[model samples]
Target: MTLFSLVATHADLDLETVGILSSGAADVAGSVDVPAVTLATCNRLEIYAEASSDDPAALEASREELIDAVAETSGVDRDTIASTFRTLVEDDAVSHLFQVGAGLDSAVIGEREIAGQVRKSLADAQNAGTVSGHLTRLFETATRTAKDVGARTALGSRGRSIVSVSLDIAGDMRGDGAAFYRDACVVLIGTGAYAGTSLAQLQERGVRDIAVFSGSGRAEQFVAERGAAARALKMEELSEAFSAADVIIGCSGGNRQITAQEIRTLAGIGPEGREKDLTVIDLALSHDFTPEVADLPGVELITLESVKMAAPAETEDSLEQAREVVDAAVQEYLTERQQRSADDAIVALRRHTQSVLDAEMEKVRKQHGCTAAAEEVEFAVRRIVRKLLHTPTVRARELAAEGRTEDYVQALQDIFGLEVEPRERPEREQPAKRRRAEEFTPAELAQMAAHLQKVPDGGFCPHHRPGEFAVERLEVAQRLTQAQAS
Candidate 1:
């Protein structure tokens, strides 16, 4: 089977489309015949599937199947769904997932939440019985790479998220900065994971006057479970909750949109019938509040779009370090996957050798009549066969790692007339085609050296020893210098 990914994110589509797709496309994983994982986050709706065949026509059919599944479940137009998704195959697909798991593709860079979301997506696929061994390994590797990125980069120290970024925008708009979070009368909408996280963050920021309202009517139980840090709001008390709140946060993105008129009627009602300033921060993907609310007087609005625009940029050094981790991790995964392709050929060679050994031993037993000489001859022949097979076995793995499995298979066919079973070997870009040290300036090399120093010792494989990457680059530079002199 071949790997493929269909990605629709805020970078390519509007947040409304993403939200709608994520919420509505629940049965997408099961709709396909192959192993599939659907990662539906607020910012992206991604489908990772292992196609039953690697043929171009078969891959296209798989894409059509997924599009049909999503459209059927989400009530979205088939053409629209097709247009919104960007298909990635093999290496690109694997790299994209790693980037997402590492939080490098999130609205807020290095956000820790996407990593867990990635893991949960895999689990959901498993529960749905749509996951395969390859898909499981792919997701598990992505999760590990994400954790490695977090531990090795400055992103772990920052711990920023979409919620935090939204609050930062709210704080800036309120004019008192973060200090306003301490005294703000905040009302949170929704009782989901985001709502729980927002509550914890609010409490961490010293906000005590917090109330939570669940459109699904679970706020009472949710608040009770969380203790006294927050209070639950009944649907009838929304007017009063809005009137008393300084900051409103929407996390429960449900079918119903909180209309502009509803907020204008009850928001910030002073005792003297005056409207006070209010900041409405909508972090929901489906938008808990209407966009028209921003037009209301004395009200400010912060949305997922606004938060995305206001997301702070990470330091270049930290970002580069994180990217190096991702690159290394992707390379390691690709190497291991490629090495596995050699297994069938190795088995075929060993099987053929064993059959020949058994035939020769039978002849020896017939000629020597089961004498000690026959046993001695069998032992020597078996030892010789093993010794002869060692180089070919090692060569098979080396060739496969270099994306030359076909060459090794052809060699076996030519030399031994061995017919190995055809296996799926996804095509990958050769590493030599990547950027070389000869293409970089001295200053760039120096910067790379500095970044390499920040990378933790060792790598995903023993072949990648500490500082080995740096050594390779320097060797390339020296080779270039020698060629120029010659």
Candidate 2:
């Protein structure tokens, strides 16, 4: 099978385009004849597919199909995409995926959400009915390796995601994050995944009494799930809520932006509307708040562009640890794959030899014509067969495990005069039935649930406080805006 890949990461593509690419990939599965899986996160859009053949024309056609699908969905030029989008084939494709799972390729460098994203990609393929055993094995290996790296190494010892990073930045925004969250009346906008995440973050920070405004009018149900007694607001209460809110976090789905006019109207409402030192965080890809709203008096807006993970200072050591883990995992995978490939040949050779011995033993028994003589003759032949086959069998298995299967197969044919038919592994109809990953104890579920949400670190991160780059950038933007105002 010929594996193919294409990647667009945070360095090049925006999150919106990445979302488009993911949707395209989901739809593209219907069109491609080959088995394929797509993994799209805020940081990267990647696809892995195994074609039936490695013929150049076939590969080229497959490549073009992927490029065209992404182009149509994201409206990017094929050539432009080809320029920056990395392509990997066969083993290289496998290596890239492993690194991604290991978090070596993460934007935040060893972000924890990637493992879940990898799992999600596999699940999505399974639900789409586009992936089979090979992809499943690869994904399982990658995820297992990722968990190993996280647990064993310093690569992701703290375990952080984009949510944590964003929260860390927010924490550093107004002194300590924990302090800000504890005292602040947080107004959470949106009723989707991010909203849930934000609430979890607040809960983690000991923040309750959160005002929920559901963009989809499902606030009551969302609040009910948490057993929260806080009153859920309708769409109209958003402005009134914002007036008293110390922080308004927007993680709503879609393109419903909060206009500058809305803030102005709130300000015009007199005492309650005159909010001081308001912090607005728009975590949505399609920003929930307009930029002009940030220019409002007593307002501060932090979007994805401004907020980023506070990368650990001693990251060189962490990166080295991560690389080592990935390298070891890859080597292990390669060895296992080789051993599996060898199993069929080894089994075939043994079966072919056994059949010949059985025929010879039958002849010897017929010639002996006596029970005692036939038994002795049978024992002798078995010993001869064992002695004759021992060295070749042992060497063949060794060669197989070492990725020298062709030589092993050839040696069997040349030395043993046995031509073994290649064994075919049929596609498994279903994965071995097992508990869903989501099945866990209440405490375990809470921890896992927190992983999916916007979990803010408690100010102990390496990038905890603002550095020169972030501070300078903030100052420059403020200066430019001030000049424009004057």
Candidate 3:
């Protein structure tokens, strides 16, 4: 199956529209016919799906299906959903996911949180039984690629995020930089992932007095579970909490917009009674605080928009390093996927050869009555067959990686009279074994990390050329064939 994705991110739509799209993202998978994974973050809502074919018309139909499902579920109009969501097909889809997992696509570039979110989206799809083998590999590779980028580049090492950027802006607004965090009485309105991240970041900056409020009444549970030495604010306690808080962070992922008037009324502050400076950070896609809150006396607001505008530009060296890693990863993933396309042809050719060997062995057994000589002949014949098949096997992979698997299959059909119908091996019986993340030793990883810094464009070292490597391998195989023939 060909992979495609319908992506509606903050880049395409306003954060509010993204939030609206994300609200019902969980249900979109149920409406689609194909194996699907829905990645619904605060600023992005994407459905990565496996379509039946890579044909443009077929992919367009698949896109329409996904769009209809999202429109129905999200209550976004069909036209808007169709126009807003970017449809990425096959290679483009794969590349986009890798970029996203590497945090290159984040609002706060190189933010560490998105990698985990991408992984979680895969897990969520698996849990819901909506994931396929293709999609599973896609996401797993994306995660692994992200880890590689994180390890090899300076991009993701700092664990940057909306929370961190917001805090930085808040600190600057407070005129004390990060030192202001230590003395700030922070009130966090959210118990979700962003809130948890925000809480961790706040504590990391030496903030001590913190309170969490969940609109869904999970504040107490969230506080207890997180092991934070902070209080959970009850609904009635919000007024007191807001009034006392020096910094208010909103990440509750709720729809109720906490308006300027609401904050004023809740905090018991009036037009003439504005007492202390307050920093309001609305990190939620569905903003918890209204935009007008920035108008309040002594109030400084940091919304996602503000963060996007104020977010520091990444150093070119770090960004270039990350992109190199991602590009290499994308090419590798595509080559592997392309090679897998030849599996059925390879299996067919091998089975055909095995049948020929079996028939010849049957004749030998009939003639020799299972003698030692018969066994010897069988062994020699099998060895010869393996040697003869080796080049075909290698060529199959090479052809497939070059997107010429159809030619390989046609050659087999013409030469061996083998008609191979493509078939998927059962998941349990799948042959390709991916190298696990843990397989690399620390020393090897360090070498790779160092190589990334030194390697120029195309992500290959001076010692290796991909084209030359493939040519050398094929030449070696040809020499082996010549030796066997001689």
Residue 290 deviation, candidate 1, in Å? 1.6
Q: Please give the distance, in angstroms, between residue 290's alpha carbon in candidate 2 and its true position after superposition.
A: 4.2
lDDT of 3 by residue, 1-486 (tens): 678998888787888789888877888887788889998876789899987765688778878898899889878789988888888888999999999999999888998889989999999888887888789889999999999999999997867887798899999888887678888899998898899999889889999999999888998999899899789999999888888989899988676889989988877667764678788898888788888998887788888888887888899999999999999999999888767768878899889989989998999899779999999999999999999989999999889878888799789879989887546435653778865546756565555545444444343456765344332112333343445446
- TM-score for every candidate vs. truth? 0.78, 0.71, 0.79
The sequence of per-residue lDDT tens digits that candidate 1 reaches over residues 1-486 is 679999999899889889988866658988778779999888999999977766788899888999999988888898998998999999999999999999999989998889988999899887777887788889999999999988888976688988888887888888776689888999999998788888988988899799998877899899888885888998788889889899999989788988888887767543343456889988889888999988777788899999888899999998999999999999999888777768888989999999999998898788778888888888899899999999999999989879888788778889999987645435343665667656888777655555544444443234566655543446644444445446
TM-score of candidate 2 versus the correct structure, residues matched by position: 0.71
Give the clash count for each candidate. 0, 0, 0
Predictions in order: lDDT = 0.84, 0.73, 0.84
Candidates arranged by TM-score, highest first: 3, 1, 2
Task: Rate residue 257 of model 3 by lDDT.
Answer: 89
RMSD of each: 17.7, 20.1, 15.1
Give the least accurate 10-residue stretch of model 2, judged by summed lDDT: 468-477
